[model samples]
Target: MTRHPSDAPTPPPAGTDNGPAVSREEFDALFATVRAWGRWSPADRGAWNRVTPDLVRRATALVRSGTVLPMARPWDTSPGPDNSRPALHYMSELGDLEAAEPSAHKDFIAVDYHGKAVSHLDALSHVAYRGQLYDGRTARDCVDAGGAHFGAVSALGPLVTRGVLLDLPAVLGCRWLTPGRAVHADDLVSAEQALGVTIGEGDAVLVRSGSLRRRREEGAWDPGAASAGLHVDAMPLLAGRGIALLGGDGDSDVRPSPVEGLHSPVHALALAAMGVPLLDNLDLEALSAAGAEEGRYAFLLVVAPLHIPGGTGSPVTPVAVL
Candidate 1:
């Protein structure tokens, strides 16, 4: 797809009644525009169409230029093997339903979702806007007792494409990115320059704000309390480039509110309205350090989110091979 001469502006707030829901006609038109501009063939029309062979070739070229780094923080649930994070517990056994296994066979039967895992990405099914999921799938379609409507961890296919890492902390010369820190479009460009890479259309841009570092060190990375992330100003640039996925090292850059609560602006606006997937809580400190030391950036980015039929985000391991 032809890149916009420059990044577009951020979208309006989702709750604004003036900003009507994107109509079917409007959605179809936009999709058609992207398809025509990208010279996409109908035969390549599934979700994977955005990340074609050419995209993989370019991504691989970047990876071969240097060392590919894994950008996922290790999920630490238990403290001293006793005290554990609640989120981790829910993820591992989905509420301790499998805790009855014998010690010797525990590891064998263990199905802990919260662990030091990687190579995963979030499906559009993970989040929604006004109760609607990606591609207009309803929220109800994603849940069932037997399993997720879409299935788990195996439904998502390989996501291979040109992945750009936007290191905001490095760009700003900050050691840690805080909650509520709003990164604008200029910040993304600045980070791109620091890495000597130009983001392209359909790239899976991973934005790093150093939030993971804080989580690793403090053991408490509260989305509601932390400050970090791209402002709404960065969305247009992302959308205009046909970005297929937006990855980050935290649940979101913006802080959650107690009163006028919004889960995540980036996720809701981009995925539900624009059809882009959001990959969150990634680990990128190691990758950033490696890139800075080598003075090179680019890599074959690979993330295959669990194919849970109707789940939102899955634990993932995102690897960046240089």
Candidate 2:
């Protein structure tokens, strides 16, 4: 029987074949090594505090041709294996009886965007590992059904900084990485060298696994279940570099998570430990092409999330300017 998009698939059995590979002991040790609980002063903004006026000015200096690319997937109204809860868009007011002389068309839009479908920003409160959010705030104390009381999307308004495009497939001479491939820290260094770009302080690292492009040509699969992205080992490098933000076609976590006892282990280490808010499910094909054409990978990246008070995260359309 053909499964409908609305129908959730039966979860595979958990073990070495399906679940995370690393043991609990290994995952915990790695978590403690990179945890930055008390580093940032005002913890709501998290690692974004690293981006300063000087860094923004420096980022602006990277823009030469002024080519702009918006890195958001189209408002996804269709449900699929990846898009479990599809975005909603409909004309609420056609403005026939409501308007006097002039007619107007207005639409209402909403989404459960933190999944694999939408390009969005994940606030620090979005992920809570071991009952704690960023800066060691207890998740139960800070977040509730009402919404997050700390590290809400409103606090992370506009982020503008240097963006590094690690076009992995381009570097590897492939169209796309296989779904479940893990990108280690060595891949980052190799990609940087191959692309003639170096990631400095306060940079927003945008990695392109080209999974979305492959899905376009091939077919849609469950990215949340299996997607090519950075492993937990890769986070230490970015964390050490003082990255303001991290983003990718995937949510920066390779699955089956290298770490056991966690589904999104990288998310936990990034948001909860390193205080690094994440940008997830970006369509970086345009950015990849732009980088190849220009022969440069670093550019001025800009992200502005909706200012929803106490919101856990926001649907965002990040732009890369070269």
Candidate 3:
């Protein structure tokens, strides 16, 4: 297989006779294709570059004509590893009302381990490889008197662009994609055909594996259970397509964590190495349904990560205007 610049090392390629996973060189070649298509810049330009004004006009018309819909789900508790991450906490305050009834107030705190909720985008400063952050900045450089860094969600601005949802489960003949299932580039193409839309450059491509539904129904995460996610080989495909953001419903499809046992190497590769953003734990059920019903794939996509400074990831509410 031809290697792309953005392709990370992967197992041998898939085979008709169950051969080893894709070779590293072949994976690299695939990634190179993605890298070649990307507009490598730190500025906040997203998938809009790939969208034509005509497409935007059509989407707007559909919204005005009530042919398309906006799909956004209300945030509830987030999912985590065995519910280890606290989803919400409340601090109560009691106050005296003098001669009146006692008064109290409760402050609500939410932990966003589930990756759903109003949150900020994780800057490269949030994670490190060998202790180096984005732009070669160290964690120390990101801290000050407050010990804060660029990881805060507030650091990210409004990420406005044309968003495309690739419904992989629909293409794969399943309502719920299982864990450990690797979605390939061909799956993406099939989804595009099914949706009657073509993915273009600079689009924020969302891959829906239906894993979120299973997780929600199960009500807890099983560390040992496999979950559906992007194949490592698909990175180059995304990069080759010039996708600005690559988001999905799970952490990643790769196994065994790449950074000395640290999970989420996809974050490292996309955010740190490729300068691309990764959206996780997004609620795509409504969007998928709407797209299928309307027979359209492109939409006016809006996502605003929390502006928190020096934070790793933020809970986000992403909306799609069809």
The TM-scores, one per candidate, come to 0.70, 0.92, 0.71
Give per-residue CA lDDT, model 1, range 1-322, as digits (tens). 1111112222223211212224445444443333222233321122445777887876776655557577765554444321133233233223355555542222211223422233235555555656765455566766556544542334446688877777766665555655666666776777677667887866878887666665556665345454567655566666677776787776443653211345465666565556666676677878777667666555678886655554545666777886
Best by TM-score: 2
Every candidate's lDDT: 0.57, 0.84, 0.56
lDDT of 1: 0.57
Tens digit per residue, CA lDDT, model 2, 12-61: 22211322366878888888988888887688998899999999999999
Off by over 4 Å in 2: 1-20
Q: Roughly what TM-score does model 3 have, to 2 decimal places?
A: 0.71
lDDT of 1 at 34: 35
- Candidate 1, run of 10 with poorest lDDT: 1-10
Report the C-alpha lDDT of model 3 over 1-322, residue by residue, as the tens digit: 1111112222222311111255545544543444322342332222323445665555455343244333334444544563445466556554553455666665676665433332234544555544555444565777556634543444456566678878766654555655566666676777777666676665778887676666666655553344566665566666667766677656544433222344554565565445566776666777777666666767777777666554565667777776
TM-score of 1: 0.70
User: Weakest 10 consecutive residues, lDDT, candidate 2?
Assistant: 1-10
Where model 1 places Cα greater than 4 Å from the true spot, the runs are 1-48, 79-120, 141-155, 217-221, 257-261, 307-310
